[model samples]
Target: MADPTLPRADEAPGTIAAQVNKGQQFTSFDVNAFEIPNQREEVWRFTPFRRLRGLHDGTAVRTADPSIVVDGVTDGVTVETVGRDDQRLAEGGAPFDRVAAQAFSSFTDATVITVAKETELAEPVFVKVDGPGAGEVGFGHIQIRLEAFARAVIVLDQQGSGTYAENVQFVVGDHAHLTVVNVHDWADDAVHVAAHHIGVGRDAIVRHFAVSLGG
Candidate 1:
């Protein structure tokens, strides 16, 4: 039998960021809406497709509980409550292809976390995503930004009951330093998909580490 799930032979090389960005505009690309003709594709080979498919058959987006803890000295970093106007929360962009945009629409209401200007935070800012239902699926989105000369550490904890998908985006300013640690601790039956977009300005340094446990 012929392999029906293979990516194109002549796919472009580069990170999704490099391929999607045209000058200053950011293009939207949903990996789930597209097809890969072969498993040799850089991003698709390591992914568990069968598990991912099971997740797609799950549920829709819903309201989630958010827990944020900002510890230690925080003169440089200020946790602000944003009401849906942040650029990281903007919608409608050219997808990696047409199919993605048509399949998965952008979510509404993303928690915007910001590190203020000239603020050098000592400890880490923890953001935890939790849900209420069991054997239930949920969806959530988050956005983070750091101003010029600011420095901070951010830990994003993604956890759910049954199965879930979370969309996250980040922006770092010039001369800023940001260290992000993503910890995914979910139930064995949970299927979680996290999408991250990070933009590092000139002279900015952003380090990311992801740790996953269970599923």
Candidate 2:
């Protein structure tokens, strides 16, 4: 189906940003608030619906728990698994789309990583997520926070097989520097969709690098 509200001829490509602003906005965990995508919306237009394995339409269900591991822990860092109601979950930002909202709504636990102020890590933190298996669909959420003047580097490594949707949020405090690298190396049949949101504070430096080797 074609989009009913197409951009006018006079509208420049830059107008896309305004479309993003005008799109659905939700701050709470309610999947019912967002409409199911029909491949007409900006976000779903480019996505491969068949590859999603019913994640967008809500037919997918979690079959097995994926393995999540965090390595290279430092003294100044704290990591914890918190509930969705935790106040820290809202520190980053709200869900920006249906998949993000679904992820937040479906995930049983949320991972929070915090770097204390004025702390510098000698080694990079590594987060690895391994898919449950084929024919299983999973949802996950992760939040990373860097306190004022903290400096750190984080690497997210994804691999294995399954249909997965995830939301990752990064909040950088003033004068902090955070660099994130995401590496995707999944099985050929794996389907993974992830959205990343970053909130940078005054004078903060944030860098994101993505490397995809397989799907």
* Index of the highest-lDDT prediction: 2
Q: Ten-residue segment with the worst summed lDDT in candidate 1?
A: 11-20
lDDT of 1: 0.59
**Model 1: residues >4 Å from true position, as ranges?**
1-26, 29-42, 53-86, 91-106
Clashing pairs for predicted structure model 2, backbone only:
none
Q: Give the Cα lDDT of each candidate.
A: 0.59, 0.81
TM-score of every model versus the real structure:
0.67, 0.85
Candidate 1 lDDT over 1-215, as tens digits, reads 43322323443221133322334332344444344424576645676666653433322444343334434435655455454445445531233422223222434445767788888887788887764346565545567888898898898876656555655667888999999998988767666666676778889998999999967
Residue-by-residue lDDT tens digits, candidate 2, 1-215: 53434434544221221233446343434565567887787757887787788777778877765778899998999999988788877767766567777777788788889999999998999999998788788888889999999999999999999888888999999999999999999999899888798999999999999999998
The local distance difference test score of model 2 is 0.81
State the TM-score for model 2: 0.85
